[model samples]
Target: MATRDTHNLRSVLAVRGFRRLLGVRLSSQLADGLFQAALAGSVLFNPDRQTSAMAIAAGSALLVTPYSLIGPFVGVFLDRWSRRQLVVFTNLLRAALVLPAAALINGGGKGVAFVVVAFAIIGLNRFLLAGLSAAVPHVVEDRRLVTANSLSGTLGSICFSAGLGIAVLLINVLVSAGDSGYAVMALVAPIGYVASALLAWRSFRVDELGPDHVTAPKRAPMHSAIGDVVRGMGDGLAHLASKRGAAYTMAAKAGFRALFGVLTLAMLLLYRNYFVTDDDVHDSITGLAFVVVAGTLGVMVAALVTPPVTRRIGGWRWVAGLIAGIAIALPLTVSSFTQPLLVVAVFCVNIAAQGTKIVVDTSIQHECDDDYRGRVFAVNDTTYNLSYVLGLFAAALTLPADGHSPTAVFIVAAGFALIAGWYAVVAGRWARRVGDDIAQPDPVPTPVG
Candidate 1:
């Protein structure tokens, strides 16, 4: 099974366009990691800042919510526009936007100018990600999408972590310089964005990665067109409703992410206030970096584990079982609250998260029409971030400064168990009624040029 999976992966990688698209995703995600690390250092972990659970959670909400609200609306354009062009343009724009943001950090300016620039960069990131996901079907054969998504998403995640590690190292090296150090770290992110843009510009023709069918009104006035696009979100939702498997998988992912968010905040506070037990913010950064590495390694493990397991038992069952496993394991690993044990917990949770995401993404890509794919993915991204932010705030209300709350861990565990059971029951009934064998693979196509 492992040998066959490896062959399938190699086959997917051999496709020229898949390789290029994967490059675009990797470079873009790497920049995401770098920019996020710099933001975390400047906003949350700076020695000058007084950090707490509520403050951190609020900051996270502020950074995520505005873009999330507009994500679905943005999807309308993704369906109308050339995705390759969108990828290239958004990357260049992000690169341009980061400069002033970095300069603001350099001058220790955390005012409106910094916030506005930072929000613009993050908003463009959402568009780039949705465009990338929607473009996957254009690059790979239908039968190979599961493997392609696993490889692309997992590798992208690892590269993002790599960027984080790199930025963190730079910040630590220049810790004496304070805000200027973080500013310098942020400037490094644009290089990745430019590389991604250049690769996309060079690798494919203008129309290669596409919304093959454009359904927007041709001659409508600008305001009227804007209204139609907003209304188009309903069409996307209606289309999603018809694809029960994809809808169920997306719901499961949203539930899992909310719980993941709670745990994430707990982990951060633990490192900052509990594990380090000292004044130096650098210690907390180092500790948190280890946890992030553990999680990234676990995501890689899932890329290997999920394809074969889903092939054996089907994607939905595998997803439910993985979530169940996390429910049972989380309390035990987190109850002790020791750094080593928490690392193990993070590793296990990410395996479940990434494995579920791989299945969810594949199911959506396979089931939905290309016309609505962008909006569906936009909805997907919005739900993903919103659930996470809500979870963060919810946990913040219960968590203390040191992040020690056994009750919180147990409650999260129970929530995971409920999500697993709900998904299993709902999805099982739907599959039976629809007579769809989701486990069945599509026949592999001849290799692409």
Candidate 2:
């Protein structure tokens, strides 16, 4: 029985449904994280750090194209299948896709194909991601969403960081002990996939959204194919255009992306006078922040707390203000480090700004319908890549040569960050025009059976 008495998150977490959801999340989150690390590590840990980072950035940037093309259709896929099943199968498929790369470690001519295979895996995996992201809220009661996001965020951070650190260990162990150690570790992909798939398959049972179960199935004639395609395209497009929530979310996302572009550059060695490759700077204490202790911890704090903060503030507007404050602080943060204590203060401000921004940004993105939200998210992802590239290129070219000492790079970028914050604030205001207004509920009612 649903408990009216379950008023708090603690109560909600204690319930069987959320516990089941958490189990399923735990099973899959680690693998999903490992997948990302493999991709980023392939690029980041290359013999040449900067060159590899730029190359990977460029190469992976292309993945966004398919996501844009396939996004609208993915939502349709979400509606048609069982959410639980999709979650499991996607992980399983990831395992399968990566296994070949792992198995043929020393095979002739295959070394070159590893990157290509990884790319393909990435593309196909989006289908799973699209479905799983759409299904999260469906699996939990509304009030417990903060807890869900918090737990998921923490899991994601640990999973990604650990995968990066451990993958190396696994690779080393395999190379020394087994001929196919490389290939063997590749099995991690599939192992995690299959395990998560099992969890998904067994943990939840739900209905697929087809007519046969509810009424009767009717076959469409082959002649109707063109009409069907046209109808699908139209529906997808209409769904996006009509969604005030999604639109506002994207607008806010765009601003965040823009500001994030500037802020990230600010954190670089070129922008920060403190050594660009400061081990202390990069490795924060937060196990969840991955490398940055403060950053990792800050992110976890935001993840666990942002939802309630949002609830208390009442809307995206307050969040926009916080982001704006961060943007304004970005350039100033560099100058704030005149002394040792100031350096610590500078870092804390950056962390707080980044953490709060991310928590708010992700929540808004996922707050809409499943189908078109995929397309919207794809667009958001695409924009994020482009923005990152643009900022990096600009930094490399235009940033001052004086190790973050001159205000030029920070100044220029900070201006943009402020603009982004203003843009987000505007979008928040307009979000009301759409439906993301904290003051208003979802504009369109979800479909009822």
Candidate 3:
């Protein structure tokens, strides 16, 4: 009863900062969805199937790759400087970049410049996401972290799914009106970007404490740039290795992330085959049934249940079970294509996996110390993105454009999930051992008279 009450109180029904961030997340996602719609169907119009897909991906990667190069340096800066200023700077620049692309679309130019600018805007937006993720924890209290994150994740999923829906719907409307649909699609992102910028500029204070409290800035002596950078990176890596428990967390997260990447590739294939009909949604409303509704509910359960579950049931045992369930579900769904009983099983797996994933990720973040938090977190981000790219490329090669493509992706992703489940099992054991080492009782507190 007390536990239930505690969960209710920590319920995190509202926190102003989180609420603001949530709104921005939704708006940005709506725009992102529009962009996806803008790029999706036309890519295949070019000669080679693989080539066009790559072109579309490459355009987005143009943005992503640059951000990857800059993100670490940016993360370091985020820890070292005024976070608020950084937030405002990133938001304003992104908003400015986004507006012109939309204007170009409005003016009826789907030229190289329009695509190129859109790519750059998407890439830069990542740094803003990084900045926001890094800053959010600082603004919210420590205990409130899980609830805040859980809710945020739920909202993000909803917005992302809805954004895709909105993009499709808007494009349909534009076509009916005989307008260049790119303008309508492109406009969505800029509106969200501008809104996010305004929210940051007018509402939130650039939090100074996190930067102020972070580890001392490491300045290498003037020397050969390459050699110095390599050595500095080595030193930073050593600190990450020192945290035994943290190491387990990082390893598990990386494996899970890799699996996540594989799943993403599978999802694109799934939607292409199952949901789309001549670029129009068919009678099936699974996108609505699966993502917007079920996915959101899963997040809610994750947020509401994970804390107590982890504290009581412990970690690995719970996590391993979740992934294992996914492993079973994905293959069955792919092989049977959600045959009679299999479809229900797949949905159940999705709900369970999402819920536990929330707990596991949140706990990992909590374990991160302030000193190397940026580096560690950045590594997670980099690895996840790279994994996503590789998985996508591989799947695109194997998965066909037809409806059957989703099945192949699912089978491959199931393999990835099995690997993830294995990691969860091993990492859980490691976490327990680490716990034992740290469990040595604190030296008796000096007794007050």
Candidate 4:
């Protein structure tokens, strides 16, 4: 077994390419944070907007569903094109898309135009992120993947939260409590996106972050891209099917995400409506923001602890335990709808969710072939976004205006328990099939241009 000292984050960051990649990841996520916060504030919390659990679910669906629908196909391009170029082009495109979105918000437009543009921007974001995940192995050694993922994912999350905070502050300082504030906040995201694009352009040579030089088919006509995408997605799924461990890990992560989505939507409704009487929008937003802050702290702690814990208990077992932890923690912490208890629930769930994510990411990176990594991660992304949307819709149906539904919480807990059991069975079967391969250390492959 490798000692703790070997996987230290400082040693991983010492790699120049990884450091540059981290910069791109952090910058892009910060922009996403700002963009999402601005959109949420405009759509859900503006005084002119009618806020309800159903509306919140609709908003969440709008932001995520397009990516869920189109993200898998986009992964095809990730494998065919230069990922470094994808990172650069996608960010630049996103910056352009944000312009119309910001204008629509400023002009009080809320129909199809706004939704279409917003959807496109987020869809591009999915491609950019998948490329980054696929490129991570190229930038760092396999032995250091856990530490690298922990640092990048955890810190990128922090940057996102920081960006949201900055957007809120910008709104307060720049404009009134209506559409104009949201509009101005939307403008901030473009700056971050442009900066991220430049960083990506300057960070790596063309094809340095790669699809391993395998012969890829020539780009099809525009009319055939969709067909290509479907075939490509099928291929990706087949590849993952062969790697049972990665496939099951994604399934477990999807279940955890669905439960987390329920918790998120419920908490948003709780703060926006139930926690504060008299519809005090400001206080409700403040309460939700505090919960986010607490969750961020919990994510940091999870990053600190997960590497060691995964090392101690195999990554698969550790993920199973975290999933089980959610089932146990959810009912215990959130059955009562008080603010203090909800804060605790948020903190605990974030730890489990983030820890599970770290394990799943590292396991996929280790177990899956490099050539198929982007598509696999794209499928993983699709699973997460779609499952969360499903959970949101489910919560919208069951949750009352007050968001105090122990029944709903219990249902989610039950789902978590079922998922945990499924993960255990899958892990055991995979272990038996692979024998000691999971335990044996393999040298990182040489990078392909």
What TM-score, over all chains together, does every model reach?
0.96, 0.71, 0.77, 0.93
Higher-scoring candidate on TM-score, 2 or 4: 4
Residues 1-449 of candidate 4: C-alpha lDDT, one tens digit per residue: 34543546768878999999999989899999988887888877777767778877887788789888777877777777788888998899999999999999888748889888888888788778778988999988887788888888899889999988887677556665578888888888988899988998998988789888744467679768777778888988898998888778888888888877788888887877788776456776678778889889989988988877776556778788887888898888889777888899888888888888887788778888877788888888899899999888888888888788889989989998999998988886786778622233446689999
Better of 1 and 3 by TM-score: 1
lDDT of 3 by residue, 1-449 (tens): 35653753445555666667767666776666666554443342211123233443454455456556655544555555565566566666766775677576555435778767766766666666656566656656655555566566666666766776775566445442122455556556667667776776666655542554644446676565445445544454676676555555455555655555555444544454444554443223335335444555555555556555554555555566666666666665555544333344434545655555455445535665654555555555555455556555655566555435545646655665766666666666677766732112214679899
Candidate 3: 10-residue stretch with minimal lDDT: 44-53
lDDT of 2 by residue, 1-449 (tens): 01322344555576665566566655565665555544543333322233322443345455444454555555454554566666666676777777665554424213457656665667656565555545555555554555455566565555544555555555444432223433444557666667767877776665431111222224678768445544655675676566554455455555555445544544433322343334332222112132334454555665555555555554455455555555555455456533333344334444444444444335533454554444444444445545555555455455443235345535644654665566566555656565543332223768999
What C-alpha lDDT values do all the predictions have? 0.88, 0.50, 0.55, 0.82
Ranking by lDDT: 1, 4, 3, 2
State the lDDT at 299 in candidate 4: 92
* Candidate 2 ranges with C-alpha deviation above 4 Å: 1-7, 48-53, 103-112, 168-186, 206-234, 258-293, 332-449
Q: Rank the candidates by TM-score, best first.
A: 1, 4, 3, 2
Give residue 334's lDDT in candidate 1 (0 to 100). Answer: 96
lDDT, residue 298, candidate 1: 96
| lDDT of candidate model 2 versus the reference | 0.50
All predictions: root-mean-square deviation over Cα?
A: 2.8, 6.7, 5.1, 3.4
Tens-digit per-residue lDDT, 1-449, candidate 1: 87878888999999999999999999999999999888878877887666789988887787789999989989988888889889999999999999999999878747878777888898899889899999999999877888999999999999999998987778667544267788888999999999999999999877788899643338979999888887888899999999998899999999999998899889888888888777788788888888889999999999998888887788889989999999999989999989999999999999999999999888889889999999999999999999999999988998888888999999999999999999999887887887663465546789989
